[model samples]
Target chain A: MSPLSITSRTLAAALGGYGLASLSAMALAVTLPMARDQAVIIGIMVALLLCSGAAIWAFSARSAWRAWAGILAPGVLLGGLYLWGLPA
Target chain B: MNKSFRQSMAWLHTWTGLLLGWLLVAIFITGTSAYFREEITLWMQPEVHDSTLQPGTIDMALAALNAKAPDARSWDISLPGPRQTAAELRWQPAKPPEDGRRHRGEQILMDADSGEVVAPRATRGGNFFYRFHFELYGIDRLWARLLVCLATMFMLIAIISGVITHKKIFKDFFTFRPGKGQRSWLDAHNATAVLALPYHFMITYSGLLLFMTLIMPWGIDAAYENDRRSFFSEVFSRGEDAAQPGSPGEMVAIGPLIEQTETRFGKPVERIQITNPNRDNAQITLRVNRDPAVTDRQRGGDPTQVFQGNTGELIDTHIPANDPVSPGWRIYNFFTSVHMTRFADPLTRWLFFLFGVAGSAMTVTGMLLWVSKRTQQLRRDQQPDRALKMVNGLNMASITGLMLAIAAYFLANRLLPVTLAAREDREIQVFFIVWLVSLVHGLLRPNRHGWIEQVAAASLLWFAIPVVNIFTTASHLFTPLAWQHAAIASFDLVCLILAALGGHTLWRLQRKPLPAKARRAPAPRPFNTTNPASEQPAGESP
Candidate 1:
C-alpha cells in the first residue's frame, strides 16, 4: 500500500468514523420513541457498534476516496436526521 | 484494502492487533488481577491475618465503634466476609470543626474476634493495580480514560477483524502445534483467542461501554439537553430518608436484626448503616451479601432490610431481584456485570481469572507472532532493522518488564519501614522505577540473551516474594495463620504458580529456537493446489 493511501484511510477510520458514530447517536437519541434514558442507552450501544463497523468499512473500501465517501455519506445523512429530530 | 475481503481483514488484524497489543496486554493482566483485589489487599495487610471469623464479630465491632465515636452522626460497620478478615468501622462526627473545611470521616480496622484495632502498613495494596487498569496513574483522569478508551476501540476492531481473518477458527481451536516456531506462535494465539472468543468479545465491547458517557455523550446530551447529572440520578434513583433525630432513647440489640435479615435473604449481612444512634428515631439499614443474577445491576441491587432501631421492628425490605428494569437497561447491566464479575463466587472468580490469563496469552502470542513472522522473512546474514529491534524491545518491556515491576511493588510493601512517610506513594514509585529500568534494559539488549535474562530475573523475583514474606511478616506461608486466612495462602500460591510459569518459559527458551532459515519466507505466493479447501496464502504482508 502507498503511504498516502494508508494515511488517508487511517484518518478516515479514526476521525470520520467517530463523526459518523456521534451523528448516529444524536439522531437516535432525539428520534427514538421511548423513555429518554433508555433511548440514550440504545443510542450509545448502537453507536459503539457502528463506530467499529466504520473502521472496517474505512479499511475495506477499494480506494482512499471511497473510504472517506463511505463514512461521510452516512455521516451527512445522520447529521440531517439529528437536526430534523431536534425538539422545537 | 487488499485483493480479497479476507486478505484485507488479515491486513487490518495484523496492524490493529500489533499497534496497541502492548497496552492491551498490560490492561488485561492488571484488570484480571482486579478480580481478587479485596483478597490481595487483605493479603498485603498481614497484621489482620490472625482475625478469623467469629460469631461475636459484629458485636465486637459495634461495641468498639460505640466506645470510639459515641456522638458521631452515623456509624458504618462492614462485617467480615469470606474474602475479609477484619471488620471495618467508619464514623462521621456530628459536627465539623468551626473552620470551613471538608471533614471526610474517620475509619479504623478492627480484628474480627477481639475488636481491637490493628494498623496495617500504609500501602495502596490492590487498589493501585485496579485503578491503573483503567484511568492509569499520575495522568489527568479524563485524559487517561480517553487513552484507555481509544485502546479499547482498537481492541474491538481488532477482535472483529481477527474473527473475519481466521477462516478456520473453529478448526484451529482444536489444533496446537508446538516446536514449529512462527507456526506454533500462531497456533497458540489462535487457540487462546478462539477458546475464549466470547470473553474476548464481551470484555472489549463492555470496556468501551463503561466509558460511554465520556466517549459517546452525544446521546445523553441530545436526550437530556446536556444534563448528565439528572440522567444519572434518574437511572440510579435512591430513596434517602430525611428524618430528624428524635429524643435520646435506648436502642434495641442489633444481633436479632442481623439474624432476621440473614434469614430473609439466606445470605450473611455484609454491612450495617446506623443513623441517629442512641435516639428514638434511630434507623438501622442492613445490606446483605450480594446474590447477583445475570441481569442484576452492579450497584444498589443488594438485598436490604431497614429496622426501627429502638423498637427492633421491621420497617422496609428491598429485594433487588424484584426491581423492574427496561430491557435496554437489562442488557446494559448484563454486559457490565459479566465484565466486572463482581457477583462471582470464589470458583467463578477463579474461572474468570483463568480466562483473563487466556486473554493475556492471546495478546502476548500475537505480539510474538508479529516479530517471529518478520524475523523469519529476513534472509540469512541480514540484521534486523532499527524499527524491528525497537518493537522487540517494547514487547519485552511491556510483558516481562511489567511482571518485574509488580514483583518489586510487593517487595517494596514488605521491605519498606512500616512507619515510613508517604509509604504508599513510595511503593508505587518503586513499581514505576523498576518498570523504567526494565524498559531501559530491554532497549539495551533486545535479543535472546536479553529475553532470557529478563524472564529469569522476573522468575527469581516471583520466587523471592514468599521467601521474603517469611522474614518480613507474621503471615508467611509456613504459619498456621496463613493457612487459616485463605487469602494470604492463595496469594502465596499464586506467586509460586507464576514463578513456575516463568520458569517453564525460561526452560523452553533454553532449547535453541529454530533457525531463521528454516521458517517460511514472505515470497510471492502461488495458488495453493494441495490445500484446495483453503485458498488463502500462508504469509500476508503487513
Candidate 2:
C-alpha cells in the first residue's frame, strides 16, 4: 500500500484504540457486581492499560488492514458481549 | 507498511517526542518543584516562619474563622500541619447566593497560635510553579487540563516507543562520554531516560490518572449520568448528611476533641472544618496528617473524623479498619498518593525531585541531539538551512531560557516593591516576559554565544536571589536570624547551591565551542570546499 494509505490506517488504529478503550471501560462499569462507582474505577484502570497496548499493536502491525483488525475485532466482540448481557 | 517494527517505532518516537519535548521539560521542572509547594508558600510568606502550631491551635483557628465570617455556611481551615505553619482559611460567604456553582471566597492566612493574620508579602509564591505544572495560569482550567493531558499522552507514547526502539537500553544505561557532539547528547539522553525509567513511567502515568476525571470523563460520564458531583461523592464514599434540628444546643468545647483526635491518629490534627456553625445541627470535621510513607496496601486510611458539634460524639469516619478497606478505593488512593507524594518525607521527596530533574534533562538532551544531528548533516552538505537555524534558536530558548525565566521570577518576587498593586500577578508577568524575551534573544543571536549568555544570566540571577533576600528580608546563608527559621535558611542555601551549579554550567558552555565534529565527520553529500568561509554568517563572534 501507499504511504498515504498507511498513514490513514495508523490514524484509524489510534482512534480505534481509544474507542475500544472507552467501550471496554463502559462494559466493566456495567458488568462488575460491586457498586457502580467501584466498577467504574476498575474499568477505567483496565482500559488505560489496554489502550496503551492497542496503540503499540497499531504501529507494530505489518499492514494497515491488520492494524484495523487488531483494534476493531476485540472492540466489537467485547462491545457485543456487553450489549448481550444488558437487560433488553 | 513494510518498515520493520523498530523502524516504525523510531519514527513514532522521534515525532511525538519532538512535538512536545519543550512543554514536557517545563512541566517536569515545575512539577518537581511542587514537591515542596507548601514549604515554598511558607518561605515566600516569611513572617510565619517563627510561628508554630500551639496547643488549641484548631480552636484559635475556628474562632478566627467565626469572628471573620460569622454568617459563613461552611469553613475550610487548613490548620498548621506538620508541613505547613499557617492556617490557610477559606469560607463560603453567606452573601453569595448558592447556585451549586463554586466561586472563590475570602481567603486568609492566619497564625495558628496567635489567631492573628500573618500579613506576609503578597505573592503567589511557589504556587505559580505548582499550578502551572498542570493547569497553566491565566487560562480556562478545562482547556489547560486538556492541553496538558494531550502532552502527557504524547509523552507516554514517546516513552513506550523510545524503549522499544532502543534494543540495548539496559546496556546503554551505564554509557556516558561528554563532548562527542550528537554521540554525547544521545548518551546523556539515554542515561537519564534509562536510569530512572520506572520513576519516569510512574510519574507520567500517575500524573495522567490524577487528572483523569478532568480529562477522560467518559467512564464516569456514562456511569453517573453526567452528574459530576454525584460521581465524585460515590467514588469517595461520601458520608450521610446530618439532619438539622430546629433548636440550638450548647456546643461541646473543641479543645479536648482535637486532643482526642491527635491521640487517636498518633499525629497532630491538621484541620477542624466547621459546617453550619452556631446552628442546632452543626457538624465539626477534624482531619489529621496523611501518613508520611508509601505502603503497598490497596486501601488507604482516611484521616478525617466527623463529630456532632453540640455533643462532640463521633458521627462518621472514613479511617480504615484493621482489615483492608474497600479494594477499589485502595487502588484509587494508591495512584493518588504516588503522584501527590503527600506521604513522602523530605528525603524521599528530594529523591523524587532529582528523578524528575533527570527526566527533564533527558527531554532536553534528546531534543538537542535531533538538532545537532541535522545541523551536522546540513553542514557537511554545505547547506545553510533556515529550519536548522530556527531549531537552534528554539533549543537555546526552551531549555536554558526556561531556567533563566525561573530565576528571574524569584528575583522579581524579591525586587518588586512591597506595596505594589497586583504584586503577585506582576511577578508572574515578569516571569513570562523574561521567558518571551529569551526566545527572541535566542533567535537573533549566534546560537552558541546565545546559549552561553543565557546560562550566565541564569547563574547571576540565581546567585542574586539570596543576596536580595538578605537585604529585603531577615534570611541569609550565614546569618544567625536565618538559623531560627530553618525552612527559610535552607531555602536560601538551596538557592546558593543552584547558583553554583548554574555557574558550572556557564563555565562548561564557555569551555566547549560547538562540538568539533562537522569538519571531520564524513560528508553525506559532497559540497564546495573552496568557499567554506562564505557559509558562515556575518557578525559572527570570534
Candidate 3:
C-alpha cells in the first residue's frame, strides 16, 4: 500500500470512525424510549463497540474510499435519526 | 477471502498493539498495583503499623473525632479493615471562613486500636499510582485522561484484531515451546493473552467505559441538552443533605449502631458518616463492606443503615440486592466495578492482581516478540537499523527501566527525610530522574548488557526495601508487629517475590547464548516484510 493510502485509511479509521460512533450515540440517546441516563449509557457503550468495528472495517476494506463510505453511510443514517428525534 | 481478512487483521493487530503498547504496559502495572491501593498506603505510613484491629475500634475513632471536631458540620470515620491499620478521620467545618476562601477539611490518621494520632511521613503513597493509572502525574489532568483513553481505545482494537488474527487460539493456549527465541516469546504471548483473554477484554473495555462521559459525551449532550451535571445527578442520585443543623444536642452511642448494622448486613461496617453531628437532626449512615457478588449500580448501592443521630431512631435501611437497577446500568456497574476490584475480598483481589500480571506479561511478551522476530529476520552481515535500535532501547526503559524506577520511588520514600519540605514531590522527582537515567542507559547500551544490568539493579533495589525497613522503621519483616499488620507484611513479601522474579530473569538471561546465536539467517527470498502472511508460520492457511 502507498503511504498516502495508509495515512488516508488511518484518518478514516480514527476520525471517520469517531464521527460514526458519536452519531450513533446521539441517535440512540434521542431515539431510545428509556430514561435519558440509561439511554445515554447504552448508546455510548454500543458506540464504543461500533468504533472498534469501524477501525477493523477501515483496514480490511479493499480501498480507502470504501472505508470512508462504509463508515459515513451509517453515520449519515444515525445523523438523520438524531435530527428527526430532536425536540423542537 | 478468509485468508486475506485474517492477514489484514494481523496487520491491524501488530500496529495497534505496538504504537501505544509501551504506555499501555505502564498503565497496566500501576493500575494493577492500585488493587492494593489501601495496603500500599498503609505500608508507606509506617507510623501506624502498630494499629492493628481491636474491639471497639469504631468507638475509639468516634471519640477521637468528637474530641478533635466537636462542633463540626459533619464527621466521617473510616475504620480500618483487613487492608488498612489507621482510622481515617475527616471533619468538615461548620462553614467557610468570613473571607469566603474554600476550606478543605482537615484529615488525620489515628491509630485504630488506640485512637492516638499518628503522623506518618508526607508521601503520595499508593495514590500516586492510582492517580497515575488514569490521569498521569505532572501533566494537565484533561490531557492525561484523554491520552489514557486513546491508549485504551487502541487496546480495545488490538484485543479484537488479535483474536481475529489468531488462527488457533485454543490450540496455541496449550503450546509453550521453550528455548527458541522468537517462537518462545510468541508462545508466552499467546499463553498469557489466551489465558486471560476474557479479563483483558473486560479490563480494556471497562477502562474505556469508566471514562465514557469524558470521551463519548455525545449521547449525554444530545439527551440532556448539554447538561452533563444533570445527567450525573440523575444517574448517581446523590441526594442533598436536606436537614439543616438543628440545636446542639447529645448524640446516640455508635457502638450499638455498629453492631446492629453488622448483624443486619452480615458484614462489618467499613465507614460511618455522621452529618450535622451534635445537632438535633444529626444523621448517622453506616456502610458495610461491599459484597463482590452484588452487581448493583456503582454509586449509592452499598448496604447502609441510616439513623437519627440524636434520637437513636432507625430512619431508613438500604439493602443493595433489593434495589432495582436498570439492566444497562447494571452492566456498566459490573464491568467498571470489576475493573476497579472495588468490592473484592483479599483473595479475589489477589486473583485480579494475578490476572493483571498476566495482562502485563502479555504486553511484555508481545513487545519482546516484535523485537525478536525482527532480530531473527536480520541478515547475518547487516546491522540493526536505528528505528529497531530505538524501539529496543525504549522497550528496555519501559519494561525493566520502569521496574527500576518504581523500586527507586519506594527507596526514595524510605530515604527521604520525613521532615523535608515538599517530600512527596521530591520522591516523585527521584522516580522520574532514575527513569530518565535508565532511558539514557538503555539507548547507550541497548544490548544483552543493558538488560542484565537494569534487571540486576531493579532486583537489588527491591531486595533492599525490606532490609532497609528494619533500620528505618520498626515494622520490618522480622518484627512481630509486621505479622500483626497484614498489609505491611504483604507489601514487603510482594517486594521480595518481585525481586526473586527479577533475579530469575537475570539468571536466565545470563545462561542464554549471546545475541549472534539468537539471530536467524535471512529468509530464503527477499521476503516483503510488510506482508502479514510472511510474518508467521504458513501452515495455518487451508
Task: Give candidates' CA RMSD values in order.
Answer: 4.4, 4.4, 4.4
How high is the lDDT of residue B315 in model 2?
A: 91
- Cα lDDT, model 3, residue B437: 96
Error of 1 at B193 (Å): 0.9
Best by DockQ: 1
Looking at model 3, residue B304 earns an lDDT score of 96
Query: Whole-model lDDT for model 2 versus the true structure?
Result: 0.75
What TM-score does prediction 1 earn?
0.93
Please say which candidate is ahead in DockQ: 1 or 2.
Answer: 1
Candidate 1 lDDT over residue span B1-542, tens digit each? 45687888889999998888999989988998999999988988888888865898888888898899877777899888888888989887777556665355788999988879999889889999999999899999999999899999999999899998989899988888676667778889999999999999999899888889899999999989989888988886665643676788888999989998998889889999998888888889999877758688767788899999899999999888788889889888888988989688889999999999999999988988888777656553456687777888888899999999999999898899999999999999999999999999888777766788889999999999999999998889999989887778999999999999999888877665433443244453222212221111112122
Between candidates 1 and 3, the one scoring higher on DockQ is 1
In model 1, residue pairs whose N, Cα or C atoms come closer than 3 Å (at least 3 residues apart or on different chains), thus clashing, are none
Could you tell me how far off, in angstroms, the CA of residue B113 lies in candidate 3 after the best superposition?
2.4
What is the C-alpha local distance difference test score of each model? 0.85, 0.75, 0.85
lDDT of 3 by residue, B1-542 (tens): 23487888888889998899999999998988999888888888888888866787778888888898888888888888787778889888777566665456779998877779989999999999999989988899999999999999999999999998898999988998766566777889999999999999999999999999889999999999999999988887877854778998999888888889999989888889999988888999999866665367777778899999987889999888887789888889888989988778888999999999999999988888877677657555466677777787888888988889999999899999999999999999999999999999988777667778899999999999998998999998899999887778888999999999999888877775454432345544243333222222101101
Which residue runs does candidate 1 get wrong by more than 4 Å? B96-104, B241-247, B513-542
Q: Provide DockQ values for all models, in the order shown.
A: 0.74, 0.54, 0.69
